[model samples]
Target: MSSSAPWKQLLLNSINSNSHLKHSTYFQLATVRSNGRPSNRTVVFRGFQDGTDKIQINSDSRSCKIEDLKHCPFAEVCWYFTETWEQFRIHGRVDLIDASNSDPYKLEQREAAWFAGSVRSRLQYLGPTPGLPSLDEQPSHDSLDSSAGPVDVFCLLLLDPEQVDYLNLKSNERLAFTTARSVNAYEYIKVK
Candidate 1:
């Protein structure tokens, strides 16, 4: 096992990069349903909390993913950067930062996230609930009241990774790392 901070940093840097050509900010999130089926979807990457192992992503409070997380908090996220031919598979437990949480810090974080959202993005939470049968019609944006700020439906998903697998296709290298919640040190093993 290799506890290499630089390698982990490289992976984090790749994830945090802003290059459009790399598609670094998008990833596939996988969750398990109540019936024991796996579901996957693409989600945009949000910034991580400072000095913490938590990674953040936003979602509609009414989305299926929210319900899935409620039923089972564990999830896996896969991210690939074509430019570097590198992929990161993160195994983690999910936490929802929404109105239900009474923690002042978490509540503050949620508000910040809501305010940071673009008008168009924030409008999504204001529409008819997701995953419901619709009339084959779209909600007019003009009808939404943005002045109310983000609705209660806006949620932040905080993923606390238990393990992270980093693979570089270009170099034909793979490394698996395990994280300890109370320490910054990571233990890793090369898979290939």
Candidate 2:
């Protein structure tokens, strides 16, 4: 947040203004498949990576998005704020942090996300692998371990934005921001 990304303030404002909405934090992430197709899914915002502008997202390692990211490592997040009638199209490369990652800081982030998630939701990661036919009629409630830590399949996604396209429909304003990975400051552009 201390670093200078031109769209940071606008995005923060949008999030703040729309925070009251139940789905305000939901954003659509689009990734290119290895087969050249596009895959998109709505993911919850897990806050930023501390003081950095990179967006934090939690994922299951068994999910297709993980495979898609493994293949391309790039994605675009389309976030809309209905309260303010604003949209931000943020495109960036994602950095994945999983159980295999040895970095201490990244590992801490993964653990933090695990604890941040609701027990009911976290139980899903501990159950049968996704994308398979349901084999059990009733997933045993006794099997859930609320006290357990994040499983090996739990992962963290950090979306480091290189460019942001912002549109404010209410004000009829549009802006674009581009920042090189080499520096914190961005080259700002006015689209209208």
TM-score of 1: 0.84
Cα lDDT listed for each candidate: 0.76, 0.84
Give the number of the best model, judged by lDDT.
2
In the range 68-186, model 2's lDDT, one tens digit per residue, is: 99999999999988889999999999999999998998899889988887776676676677522111223447465667888898889999999899999988999998986566468
lDDT of 2 at 74: 97
Residue 147 alpha-carbon offset, candidate 2, angstroms: 3.8
Tens digit of lDDT per residue, candidate 1, span 127-157? 5766231211234444555556557878889
What lDDT would candidate 2 get against the real structure?
Answer: 0.84
Question: Residue-pair clashes per candidate, as listed?
Answer: 1, 1
